[model samples]
Target: MADLWVGNVDDNTSDDEIREFLIKYGFPSFDEIERYSGTGTRPAVMLIFHDTTPDALRGLQSRIHNMFWKDRTIVVQVMPERDES
Candidate 1:
C-alpha cells in the first residue's frame, strides 16, 4: 500500500476536484482520497493506493510535486509506512 500526501491544497478545493484532476492527468484509479480540514492557509489531502507498486507511486509523486492546482503549488510525497507493532 502507498499513500501520497498532497499539500498546499486550496481551501476551496473539493474532494471531487482532486479526484477528477488526478484521473484527468493519467493517474490510475486509486482506492481512496481524503481532504483534511483546512485552516485557511494550509490545506492538504491524502491519496491512498493499494494496487500500485512503490516505483509507480514514486513516479506519480514526482509528476505531481510542484504542479499547480487551484492556483496553488502542490507538494506531493510518498508517506512512509507505519510500524504495526
Candidate 2:
C-alpha cells in the first residue's frame, strides 16, 4: 500500500475538497480526514492512505507544489515501507 501527502492544509478545507482533488487527479482515497493538534484553530493536516499509486503521487506532487497551504507551503513527503526484520 502507498500514501500521498496533503499537508499545510487550511482547517477550513473540507474533506470533500480534498476528496474532489484526489478523484480529479485519479487518486481514490478511502480514509477519513485528519486534523492537526498543536496549531490551535488554523493548523496543518495530512491525508493518509493505504495506497496512492506512484503515478498519482507524481501528479499530486506537481499540483501540491510549494503551497500546500495558501499562506505557506509545508514539507510534504511520501512514507516508504519500513522493512521489518
List, residue by residue over 22-81, the lDDT tens digit for candidate 2.
576556664755677555544655666656555556656665556444465655555564
Tell me the spans in candidate 2 whose CA falls farther than 4 Å from its real position. 53-56, 67-75, 82-85
Quote the positional error of residue 18 for candidate 1 in Å. 0.9
lDDT, residue 37, model 2: 52
Highest-TM-score candidate: 1
Task: State every prediction's TM-score relative to the real structure.
Answer: 0.80, 0.58
Backbone N/Cα/C clashes per model: 0, 1
Clashing pairs in 2: 2-51
Q: What is candidate 1's CA lDDT for residue 49?
A: 82
What tens digits encode model 1's per-residue C-alpha lDDT throughout 1-85? 7788889988688777888888777777678888886776778888888877657778767677899777889988888864548
Model 2 scores a C-alpha lDDT of 0.59
Which window of ten consecutive residues has the lowest lDDT sum in model 1?
53-62
